[model samples]
Target: MLSTAGRHIISGEHGLFRDQVRKFLAKEALPHLDRWEADGIVDRSFWLACGGAGLLCPSVPEALGGPGLDFSFNAIVAEELAYIGCNAGITLQSDIVCGYIEAFGSEAMQQAWLPSMLSGETITAIAMTEPGTGSDLKAMGTTVRREGDDYVISGAKTYITNGQNADIVIVVAATASEQGRKGLSLILVEATRPGFARGRNLDKIGQHAADTSELFFDEVRVPVSNRLGEEGKGFPCLMAQLPQERLSIAISAQASAQRAFDEALAFTKGRRTFGQPVFDFQNSRFVLAGLASRLQVGWAHLDWAIARHVAGELTAAEASAAKLFHTELLWECCDKALQLHGGAGYMNEYPIARLWRDARVTRIYGGTSEIMLEIIGRSL
Candidate 1:
């Protein structure tokens, strides 16, 4: 009844871990949703609490302040957060950004950053997607050039999640613009740097509690030690890491869609119209039936993708396909669920309204559906 009933490929440890996360969110996070949404960000206290509960950076090795757990724990975190419609800012830090540092950073670099991240003493953001660049890394205008023992970075990054509160930002910049993507480099910039500035805590249509923003690096300088990997390997690193990122997105997409479905099913079964339950109506029945069918199939596919990812067999194209299918499915499920709510769905009071709004960006961010198709089509 919760959706994905048969689809969880969990061992005993994972099941216990999932329960712990579920309980933690319910007690520490869910109750404060309204206030956080109004403030446009979750409180830092909650992040600290999450870290205390062993919820952050589960996959990062213990030597680097992580629990050294598998990726399944990360997926569990992503799934549980989306299931409750909690803004996914935490998952972004743990699943996507942490993976980059863990996979590519030097030992000294990892030791410097990963501990604070694991403790939730620090917040992190990845600065890609500049104002004009969209998803094209080659067109990015951000530049990082060597100056003595430091690298000077100058550019703007927009649509950055966790931007308003990020203590550390992994910046994608061009070290040599003439080489196209070959010139790209990922620079680590502390938010307290002299020229690093955040533009605004962006007001968005939904997921208001998630702090998305614009960041500026106006000749920000950091030691050469701040670079994540090789000076010019940023694009390749991004490409390599994107499969996990996309899979993380797919997990949230599938979970949210299922949540929306559950909400609609409950509403249609209980709400009455014309002296009959809404579920008794033929149109409502058909709508729900179709959604249920799709959700079942979606869960199975999600499980398969998760399994492949666990085995290190999941390819970039497969992750793209998962992302494309699940995000589109999320949008559809939210839309139909909202429609079934009649008038209340449009009101902010209804969960469906926020779910609908939150689902919009899943298709846009993490590479748009068109970009996903392009990636997949190239392999055919």
Candidate 2:
């Protein structure tokens, strides 16, 4: 348990939730990751299992057909998923994508989707990145134009998480292209709709079990009711919710860093070199000591971020900073842990190698480290 303010950050109810998630992952996730990695996607059965375990969209209120939990519960699920390197899209679904619907969807729309989403029967993807744009929302080229009572959407999205299996997509497109960012709006695109298509499951360097793909919309049409919030107000909603999304990235990075450090410590203590255990060597001891110090500070930072987020007081800059610091730290920890493994680390058979690969994307996705720095710099 992470200690903060003279007590563990996780309380009684939270502890029970954590235990449930830990046991679920142990039985259903950790064992199958190897096959999932090889396949570049997780099975829908596992996603259904996660839903059955109450591990999706946890923060949605009971009135909205959720468990009425807060964001900390969401954080615990992310943390436990990251701990075992489960690369499926649960965190993305539960933490980032679901908020769009809960916060902006109309009562009818929420009723239509939230229940199935919480049940894991429906998977979601958010289409924001395009072939030509990333990080800059203003650069999006997808357009959704109103035609009488319907929206005609035409554009393409790439690098979309959950692309292959999404039952619904929250599409960010320009409803009024001349207004720049103000022109942007989010619309719900169901997978079975006409002219909606999934393109390549883009080959990524890591997080293979989480399907990332290119999506195409050729004059796709949906009722105006499918629009989230009001016309021309989507960017604000995105801005409001993105802090939590970045914090989710930070959560995953923090947990993965700890996992790598733990794995390296165990590996070094057991493996022999020069007639002694690697942990007995001065160099190994120093490296582990340095990582130990960083992990202590990381846990503190993460706890602070989670508290602020759950209280709805975490700022965009703070969330960006958390993302920037922890992801870079994750890369450093993974690299160092791999180095400690010497030859074994370079091999795919070791978890550190996969951890290092996966860490690379943390800095790239959820706003790149450079983007996070820019977001933070504006506050100065």
Q: What tens-digit string does per-residue lDDT give for candidate 2 at 271-323?
A: 99989999999999999999989988988899899999989899999999999
Q: Under the 3 Å rule for N, CA and C atoms, how many clashes does model 1 have?
A: 0
Where does candidate 2 stray beyond 4 Å?
1-7
Q: Name the TM-score of candidate 2.
A: 0.97
Question: What is candidate 1's lDDT per residue for 246-287, written digit by digit as tens?
Answer: 999999999999999888988989899999999999999999
The TM-scores, one per candidate, come to: 0.98, 0.97
What lDDT would each prediction earn against the true structure? 0.91, 0.91
RMSD of each: 1.1, 1.6
Model 1 sits at a Cα RMSD from the real structure of 1.1
